[model samples]
Target: MADFLNNLRTFVRVVEAGSFTAVANESDCTPGQVSRAVTSLEEELQALVLHRTTRHLSVTDVGTRFYERAKVILADIDSATDEARNATESPVGRIRVHSSPGLAYSEVATALASYQASFPAVSVELKIEQSMPGLVEEGYDLSVVSATQLPDSAYISQALGAAYSVLVSSADYIARHGLPRKLTDLADHALLQLESPVSAADEWHLQSADDTHLWTITRTPFRVNTPDALRAALFAGVGIGTLPTYTVADDLASGALVRVLPQYHLRPFTVFAVYPSRRYLDAKVRTLLEHLRATLSPALANAMEIVETFTGDATAPPASPPKRVAGTARKRPAKRK
Candidate 1:
């Protein structure tokens, strides 16, 4: 159909030029190809469009009427193509983004605000949930997800950054229950659990260097499904739990929460910006993605470095502003049981 559309275009040009050679030269094709284009169109319509003689060519009554209608069709198609091509330059549309609860709460807000400030013509709708929604089925323009390994799917994934989770507890809780000096001591203290898609509900996988330890949760006084709730539980001096460094950086800095086992951390997972396709990516989505890569990735990297520096040292002074860190640091791979 696309080729046939080109033929229709050639026929229109030939009618206006009154010579196949003229249109052929303009199109940079042979006069034979130009003539074939008209021939194909004539065969499809099963009518003679041009009365040809050795000296000249004239349009029949049927050809005259068809030419007018075909001209309008081609013009409309050209107009539509131009508008679509220019959409990337002036983006104006609503973008619906889906994200996990923890990331949406802690990370996406500032990036979204900054993006809106720059591109005031684009509006965004953010939805947060624990489970992953089908991007196309659910009408999502993009999704920000964190996982150890993404399952096989049709979506395109871009790694924004990677960060490890830190085990932390409130100072008051440590004072009341006594600080856990070793991995086994954690069994004696109340354990608050945050159930997440990438985490197990009944166990915590702790790793340091090449050694890995699995701490089974036999008893738990508090278990929640969201990162904010888990952080709140930790703040209330309920028990110790693990949180992403980005989520607890300020708390650790402010002495609201102290690192528990600084040497060991939960497995690091990547944050990904997922979308349906890379071909002709919308300007609204592309700008948002670029903004996040510039802002959010660096923020996560800085948070990891800041938290790593203060690890195992609970008496450290208030943290200064974190400096930007480039490149990922090497760590032992997580061994999950």
Candidate 2:
């Protein structure tokens, strides 16, 4: 409380001044107000910290013990304030960042390069893991998470991009088994699954032009929780699997994997950079998050752009007949004599 912190001040003053009126005079407040501050502190703590009579005031055992600890707390606060004031001209602190493995592999490392180069004075301690560490609980300044929605109310979510899952398989596997002509065609193919709560890993919903298609598998060759693992299985030609686009965008461009149903959309795993309450956002945290938004979002979008070029819109009708060149046919080669 604003008034409560000063009560610690008033308590110490009363202990040193040894009189309510004397303490009040030094603090330039009414004796009654000074008396109330100390009284409220005791009431708040449920401890009788002081004994006061008309002319005499004394500290009780609790008051003496509290005074020692309160002095240390006040001193620490003063030191923190001094450091903050001194660094007002430039940001200089270690920003602890935690990120989900998916993002850590995809964009966090790329963004951190420019971020560190830009803010040389601010150091970073980054942990790339799956744990959903709270901003305050785990002393994290920021976190990048792969989730469809906000993880908690205590933090603000800055959407970086959407996590797109696409059906893919190695080129060799597709050349061997053949591409599925439609959703139903998947029933005959070997499928690798991801452990999912939205539905069984074997169940998939794909959005078509005017309707949505749902396919369930009675037989699955493999199932895993992380997208990277699913991608690994697909790369090994284990089976056709659904993998996030962020993780496989490069592979798609290099012809390592091909999209099965380019026209349909898979469930999106939304992306967010979560940070503590915005009220106290510091310079270092602000700069790093800005860097992430500027670089990571565009990189992911551009990578996925390659995938989109192959998939063309599902609702749009098939490409119209190719326009023919008018009167531009090549002349026949002269017969040899």
Each model's TM-score?
0.76, 0.67
- lDDT of candidate 1 over 1-337, digit per residue (tens): 9878988898889899998989989989898898889999899889999887767978999999999999999999999898778666666778899888878776776677777888899898999988879999989989998898899999999999998787888888988988887898987999888898777977788999879988889889999999988988887888999998877776766667789878899888998999988889888888889988988888778778778876656645335735434322212112111
Off by over 4 Å in 1: 18-25, 28-35, 46-68, 83-96, 119-125, 131-142, 152-156, 171-178, 209-211, 275-289, 313-337
Candidate 1: residue 21 lDDT (0-100): 89
What is the Cα-based TM-score of model 1? 0.76
RMSD of candidate 1 to the truth, in angstroms, is: 6.5
| CA lDDT scores, all candidates in order | 0.82, 0.73
* Per-residue accuracy of model 2 over 1-337 as CA lDDT, tens digit each: 8778889888888888888899878878899999999999999999999998887888999999999999899899889888876554456878888877656765676677668888888888889776567679789988887775564486787888776677888776777887787887888899998864233587777765678777787888888876667777777777788766666665665556677778775766667888887875677877777788787777666656655655753222224422112221111112111
Off by over 4 Å in 2: 1-77, 85-89, 196-200, 312-337
Q: Which pairs clash in model 2?
A: none
